[model samples]
Target: MRAMAYRGPYKVRVEDRDMPCIEHPNDAIVKVSLAAICGSDLHLYHGMMPDTRVGHTFGHEFVGSVHEVGPSVQNLKPGDRVMVPFNVYCGSCYFCARGLYSNCHNVNANATAVGGIYGYSHTCGGYDGGQGEYVRVPFADVGPALIPEWMHEEDAVLLTDAVATGYFGAQLADIAEGDTVVVFGAGPIGLFAAQSSWLMGAGRVIVVDHLEYRLEKARTLAHAEVYNFAEYDDIVVELKKATDYLGADVAIDAVGAEADGNLLQHVTSAKFKLQGGSPVALNWAIDAVRKGGTISIMGAYGPMFSAVKFGDALNKGLTLRMNQCPVKRQWPRLFEHVRNGYLTPREIVTHRVPLEHIAEGYHLFSSKLDGCIKTLVLPHAG
Candidate 1:
């Protein structure tokens, strides 16, 4: 099998590797048909996440056919086409029973925080991801869902992470009808969050980003007002003005770890590793939302302490809700939305690369070249 292996920061390559076999009674081996390079994967590529070991394959959003399954995997069989959520969990765990699958206690050594995530760093769980030709899925019955006959393969793959997490973020916001929501970052997650906000009855949606291309997507795809923070002297103040000086009813932080507005924060977190992740976007969220409003976070961050505005949030009586999204929990409604033609997840896809050219794909995405919004990996492409 050929897998994308990490050699060091800013380095990865396609290398021949041994194929994974079922290691647990509930495990299944999937022959990956479609995989995506999530924006969060850049954290590992840039050495932002801790314990991202060399030779680790970094990918979490993927969909495929079951190549093999253990005896205990009763819900699926070999040849079943499935979409596996990013979470790896035991369905009967305390957290899983409560629909908090991302925090399942039985799957990860770091269960005190996040549960097992495919291809994320060791801090989440050391499981290999689906960036290769195949991947082993644990607790297969709980996490893998058969792709609906009406769904496109591209939509099924995005549901594994980006679409699900974005909708979850908006759900956490508890948006009231006619509320104004402002989303920070215009990546796929942010774009989806902005779009989802409208479905949740938000009267207005605004997307903030420094990139013109992404802001353009926000305007067209999400139907949200757009802002380029780079053009503002103070983006929070600009957001306040847009909201008639009271601030938005809700604010969301979708940019994590590598947020660029504050140079010192970005240096301390991303370059120097002094903080868990840059809190510029989060702080902006706190400042941009009105008093007693909500702030929902979907961005990926490390486990260490970050320099955030906790005191201000408390003073303003803001509801701060954040967690690694319970991906499967958001699927039912998301599936309905996709089926009804309310969303076409594949529209956000800008680049598709063969598994062998993934290193170049990573470079193109990281460098923000070619107007790249989302990049899909074809593991079995000719």
Candidate 2:
């Protein structure tokens, strides 16, 4: 099988690798039919996960047909198509019992929280990703992934990560019928946040991003008001005006470490705040939100042992809720949203390419120089 392997910083290559086989009695081997590069993938692309092995396959957001299943996997069969959750979990764990599968307490024991995940590293359980032709899924019978037949592979792929992230953002925000939501970053996660907020009954959803194309997608495709955070001299003032000075009840920062300006300046400038891949977005979201509001941070972050605005949080009385979207929690509901047509989140896919062109796909998505919002990788395409 040909899998994209991490070589080092800003490097990846499609390399021949062994096809994964089920190792656990409850495992299932899925033939990846549709997989998309996630904003989170950028971490490895940029070598943020320093702990990730040199040649490990790197992807987690994918949907495919079950190629094979172990004898204990009774609920799923060889022919069943499924969406794999980014978080690998043991359903019987303490955190899993409490509905926090990401912190399953059975995997990534060294992690401070429930931290086992695919395509991550020793800090995250070192599970191989699904970016290749096949992937091994442990505890598939109990993990958040569900085999839904009513959905297309392309559309259902997001149930694993992007859609769940969006749903989790709304869930963390406690979106309600009358609450207003402001989502930062019009990237894939941001777009999904806007859509999820609307579905959860937000009176108005306003998404912020500098990209013209992304803002357009938010307006016409997602049907939400947008703010060009670039043009606004006083973003707080403009957002206040849009929300009648109360500001949004919930503010979600979907842009991770990429929130800084030029890499050179931001790297050399004041190094305060969370020192992860995308903490600037968090700062902006905090200041943009109202005095008392909820902020959900779902953007994928690497390791950063640092402080991030505890004073502002203390002063503003902000309720900060964050996670990797905990793909395990939102998978079921996200699948329902897609199957029932409540969230057409796959609209973010601007380009689709075969597995042979994985390099080009990475280029298109990594730089995002074009209007490429989401790039889907086709492993079995001709």
Candidate 3:
């Protein structure tokens, strides 16, 4: 098998590796059909995530066919095409029974926070991801669903994480009818969050980012107002002004660890590793929302201390909601949205790279080169 191996910070390569075998009675071995290099994967690539061991593959968004299944995996058989949600969890666990699959208590050793995630760092769970020819899926009956005959493969793959997480982010915002929603970041998640806000009855949607390309995507794809924070003297003040000095009704933080507006914050968190993640975007979300409004955090952050504005949030009486998204929980509504033509998830895909060129794909996405919005990995591409 060929898998993407992490060499070090900002380094990765596809190399031959031993094929994964079913290790649990409920496990299944999936032959990778399609995989994606996600924004979360970049945290590992940039060394922002702790315990991202060398030789560990980094990928969580993927769709594939069942190559083999253990005796206990009764729902699927060989050659069954499926889209595996990024979460790895036991369906009957305390959290899982409540539909909080991302926080399942039975999986990961460090299950105090997030549950098992494929190909994420050891903090989430040290399971190998699907950025390879094949991957072993635990609790196979609970996580992987057969791809719908009417759905596009690209859409199925994106639904594994980015699409699901984005919709979940908007759901967490608790948007009300005719409310104005502000989204921080124009990445795939932010774009989806902005789009989902409209479906949830938001009257206005605003997306903020430093890149013009992504902002343009916000305008066209999400149909939201776009702002380049780099062009503003104070984006928070501008946001207030745009909202008639009251501030937006809701704000979502989709930029997590590597937010770049504040040099000091970026350097301290992303460069020096002093803080868990740069809170510039999150703090901006805090300041940009109305006093009694809600803020949703969809960004991925390290599990360390961050310079958050907890005091201000307390004073303003803002409702802060955040969690690693329960991916499968969002699928039913998302599938309907996709089927109803409200969302075209594959439209956001800007690049597709073969498995052999995964390192280059990582470089392209990490560097934000060539107007790259989303990059899919073709593990079996010829």
Candidate 4:
């Protein structure tokens, strides 16, 4: 099997590797058909996440056919086309029973925080992801869903992470009808979050980013107002001015570790590794929203200290909600939305690369070249 292996920071390559076999009774080996390079994967590519070992494959969003399954995997059989959520979990745990699949206690040894995530890092349970020709899925019954007959393969793959997480971020906002919502990044998640806010009855949606291309996507695809943070002297003040000086009713942080507005914060966290992740987006969200409004954080961050505005959040009585999204929990409504033509997840896809060219794919996405909003990996492509 050929898998994308992480060699070191800013380095990866396609290398021949041993195929994964079923190691647990609930496991299934999937022959990956479609996979995506998520924006969060850049964290590992840039050495932001801790314990991302060399030779580990990095991908979490994928859809594939079951090549083999263990005896205990009763819901699926060989050749079943399925979309696997990014979470790896046991369905009967306390957290899972409560629909908090991302925090399942039985899966990760380090379950004090996040549960098992495919191909994230050692801190995320050290599982191999689906960027290769094949991947082993644990607790197969709980995580892998058969792709709906009406859904496109591209849509199914994106639903595994980006779409689901974005919808979950909007749900956390608890947006009231006619409320103004401002999203702090125009990446896939932020675009989806901005789009979902409209579905949740937000009167206005605004997407903020430093890139013109992504802001253009936010405007056209999400049907939301867009702003380039780089053009503003103080983006938070600009956001407040846009909201008539009271601030937005809700603000979301979709930019995590590598946020660029504050050079010192970016240097301290992303460059020097002194903190977990740069909290510039979150701080901006806190300052841009009304005092009693909500702030939803869907961005990926490491499990360490971050210089954030916790005191200000408390003083303003802001509701701060954040977690690694429970992906499966958001699927039912999302499926309905997709079926009704309310969302075209595949529209965000800008690049598709063969498995052999995935190193180039990583480079394209990481460098934000070629107007790349999203990139998909074809593991079995000819």
Residues 236-319 of candidate 2: C-alpha lDDT, one tens digit per residue: 679888777777788988877653333532344333332213455676677777788888888766565333566897799999
Candidate 1 residue pairs in clash (backbone atoms < 3 Å): none
Report RMSD for candidate 2: 2.9
RMSD of each: 2.6, 2.9, 2.5, 2.6
Where does candidate 1 stray beyond 4 Å? 259-264, 267-277
- How much does candidate 3 score in TM-score? 0.96
Error of 1 at 90 (Å): 0.5
- TM-scores, all candidates, are 0.96, 0.91, 0.96, 0.96
The superposed Cα distance between candidate 4 and the true structure at residue 232, in angstroms, equals 1.1
Which residue ranges in model 2 land beyond 4 Å of their true spot?
Answer: 144-146, 259-277, 305-307
lDDT of 3 by residue, 75-120 (tens): 9999999999999999998899999999999899965888999999
* Candidate 4 residue lDDT tens string, 164-248: 9999999999999999999988889999999999999999999988788999999899999988876777788888888889999
- Model 4 global lDDT (CA atoms, 0 to 1): 0.90
Candidate 2 global CA lDDT score: 0.77
lDDT of 1 at 83: 99
Measured by TM-score, how close is model 1 to the native structure? 0.96
Locate the minimum summed-lDDT window of 10 residues in model 2: 268-277
